[model samples]
Target: MRTIEEIKGRCFITEDGHWLWKGALRPDGRANIYAPDYTRWQGDMRTQCGTRAVWHCMHRKPVPEGYRVFGTCTEKACCNPAHVRCASEEDFGLWMRKNGNYKGKTNRILANRAIGRKRSVFTQESIAYIQTSDKTGRALARELGVSEASVSKARRGDIVVFAGAAGGMFSGLIQRGAA
Candidate 1:
């Protein structure tokens, strides 16, 4: 395994031969350390995707062998190496499930249901009606089979505006505002 300090400083070489100074290949075969990019902030070694290695020092795990940390340069262009953990292709499926990282029904339907099962929270038509009309919280709650509190919360912008424009009613509610 590569020493933590070595992984932390090493740079990744991209296929085009450009030096991606973000991540490094650990000697342990399990890590790809991504170096922090030059940034305006001091000691900011986080990745563009909102990940950081704060956990590494906290977890104190050694970098694995034969692993290469590549710069994801995700849309955000972050260089946080802690986001670069690895898994064998054979264990990828298990990893996703265990980490609650998959887009299955558990994340879609069941999770939505847990939030109240109101179709309005997930539909544009419902949002338009709520935003474009003078529907009361009670009325919306009745229509959507959710609690009046849910309707109020949505209207107040305390939650996502899934109702879209119908969600506009939230402004009125906020203007008149009820918690």
Candidate 2:
């Protein structure tokens, strides 16, 4: 494994104290580090992110399990210990929420459902009708002003718009003859 000094040598410090990595970068632009015989379980060689290696070097220990090392600076290539911090999944979610870049899981699901509803030609009433009706796909499509493929999907529950229980919205609204 490379030493902290070797890692530092691979970066050039910016005026603002960011150590921009000059080594291999991931497709997403994060820095990558190749370490040989780094972990016993991972065999003779293992590839890791530069930030993670730097964090391990500075802290004298590996990041805790279920924790991630992230750069606090805007520069994705930076591996400066001062510019990086370790966070758990929950902590990261909280930070993302605080930064207005995240919505809670439930809220995100609800928002996505709303968006799908808006873009879809089928409504709650139509979806229930499609599921329960004995009508043919072509007939249902013509009646609902949608394509036969859509009606078929709805009948197969591929498009779920029913109310009540999990994975659905508008609870207590689906019923026989509701349409």
Candidate 3:
């Protein structure tokens, strides 16, 4: 177990009272809490976030069941105890929504597709609509809010190979059971 003094030494208190972790950072810029034995979060090989580490140190215990420790401060790397709190995922979403950060962006296209209200760039239905609309690529591009090149590539089947979950929402090449 790492000592509290060691952990504190790896961080510095900012002018605004945020404890910025001077260690590893996740891809999203959140602090990565490093501890030898404290691995395997929810059965995944992952380190805790720094804010969660600060809360654990302050409470001298693991986070309670059915609750997640989240940062209240704007600094995602902040490990200040006063800046962290435990909440259910739903409550966390509500808090983020109240703070104007959720915006229904996560899995938004999936949710919309589930509800039959697709809000993204292209679908099979849209591609069929464009193919049968008798409009030029530029006109279809304007109608679909995409580029003319995308319309042309979509027509030529050049965009299908790149159409997957993370990106490539420009054509009707998306298939189910993709990444």
The clash count of every prediction, one per candidate, is 29, 0, 0
lDDT of 1 by residue, 1-179 (tens): 12334543444545543323354434432234333422322334543222224234333443344432233333222324444444444465566556665456544544544455344454545555656659888888888887888667666655543332332323435544465
lDDT on C-alpha atoms for all candidate structures: 0.44, 0.72, 0.67
**Model 3 poorest ten-residue lDDT run:** 36-45
TM-scores vs. true structure, each candidate? 0.24, 0.54, 0.53
Candidate 2 lDDT, 1-179, residue by residue in tens: 36667777889988899888898899988889765322232333467777776765666555677887777777889988788888997997777667655455777767776666557676678788888998889988888889998888878766655343344445325533354
What TM-score does candidate 3 reach? 0.53
Model 3: per-residue Cα lDDT over 131-163, one tens digit each: 677789999998788999878877765543323
Name the runs in model 3 displaced over 4 angstroms: 1-4, 36-46, 104-179
What lDDT does candidate 1 reach at residue 2?
25
Predictions ranked by TM-score, top down? 2, 3, 1
- Clashing residue pairs in candidate 2 (N, C-alpha, C atoms within 3 angstroms): none
Determine which window of 10 residues in candidate 1 has minimal summed lDDT. 47-56
Candidate 3's displacement at residue 119, Å, is 14
